[model samples]
Target: MPQKTNLNYWIDYWNRTNPASDLMDEESLVSFWDKRSEDFADKIATAGGRKRSRENIALLEASGFCAEGARVLDIGCGAGSLSLPLARAGAEVTSFDISPGMLAQVQRVADREGLSVTTIAGSWWTANIDRLGFREKFDLVISSMTPAIKDAETLERMITCSRASCFYIGSFPGGRDAILSDLLSRIGKIPSPRRPPMGFLFPFMYLYLKGYRPEVTFSRRRWNETLDTKKAAAHAIDIISHDQTVTPAMNRAIQRYYKETAVDGKCIFKNEMFLGMMVWKVRP
Candidate 1:
């Protein structure tokens, strides 16, 4: 028997720890983003946001994936950050997201910019690809920092929807938001004695094992955020306390941390984020 690779172990651990994730329930996922739609769009418009977008777009352009008139499908495209740019570049862009609020924002931005983009509100995991005739229908498929690509089946399905190529952006191993980390530590939510494998490494290894030569690039950028105390506490709770209800104790801990950490009447947090951009061609 072959030894279990880190990717396999991490997948097994994630499935066990996050059981509901495999179901790919649209409501659960959609609701999470719905609450975050506005803030998410705002973040993308920030200096860090523009830098990340430009880097990813530059990578795509260099790869020849964003050729004029290319049919592009951006899965989990929130607020048209990338979709609108692709549309403006003359690609026929179909952007899909789980949040109607996000799709609405995408539409709003696209309309304001006079760029045409089709926005679909649905989950890629549960969407009927064939019924929608999206199977192998796109020249380029892009998923950036989206939770939709969680497993092998989902990743394969994403590839199936593309005719030419795919690009995925994921956090590098051990990546953590600085604010969330400090808050979680204050709240006594440290990892177990044994740290699990990094989530990003698995997909890259999985693709390699499947004979796909994915071109990998690493980008590091400093992301700084300033939020009011209440917003800061809420954001920290959301990121660190996933699936677990925030009890009064947790809330108090977050509030106290925010009060202690606030600088100049605002909660200021900064982190150098490491991201991996992976791209590969799909055989017809």
Candidate 2:
């Protein structure tokens, strides 16, 4: 038997760790995000989110991928975190998301700002570069903290669509999620089968082994939010359902918990997350 190359090894590791079945099917995933699109748009427009977007935009500008007339493709661009900024920076921005609801957020903002951003609705998992006329057509290709870029094929498609540059962001190993745990606990006997997907480790290693010198940055931060009981209930259900089935009773239980426990119709949410990002020139 032949020894596996490091690239293959990492790809295999990613596959074994984050299997497709563990993720929501396309329809469920789409519906889940669609329901939360309004909340997501609001979150990504916050001061902290703007700051983060600026940081990402700065990275692209510093790397010479974000500039006047540059063609940029932002995959899984939730509420135009980077796309809007890139458009403002004078790049030709194309924002793609699996959920039409999410894309609507981008378009709304773009219209308000008088910025031009083309919106595409499709799942990256099934996107065909050739048919989409995307092969080597973009100056920069990027995805931030999205399950869309799951494995070798998805990663390769980013490169296939890009002339040179790419940026990717993924989760780190551990963080605080008391809010999530508490939400599931409200669902009585239904447990949160929360498994942290093997994150940037395998993909980063895979890129490195393929002879790409990727510049990586790690970020850790804590965020807090207060939402109405009803919205909080919806949020919790969407999150819990992503990893495991949330029965109708479980959903009602979550809602009831919020309704009864909320003070002045509001519930508090807190989370601390660690994330990693990488930028590289795929064809340089």
Best by lDDT: 2
How many pairs of residues collide in model 2?
A: 0
Largest TM-score belongs to which candidate?
Answer: 2
Off by over 4 Å in 2: 1-4, 185-188, 193-198, 242-249
Q: Residue-wise lDDT of candidate 2 within 24-140, one digit each (tens)? A: 788887887798789889988899888888887777767766468889999998788888988888889899899999999999999999886999999999998899889999988
In model 2, pairs of residues that clash are none
In order, candidate lDDTs are 0.76, 0.82
lDDT of 1 at 162: 89
Q: Model 1 reaches what TM-score against the true structure?
A: 0.86
TM-score, one value per model: 0.86, 0.91
**What stretches of model 1 exceed 4 Å from their correct place?**
1-25, 189-199, 239-241
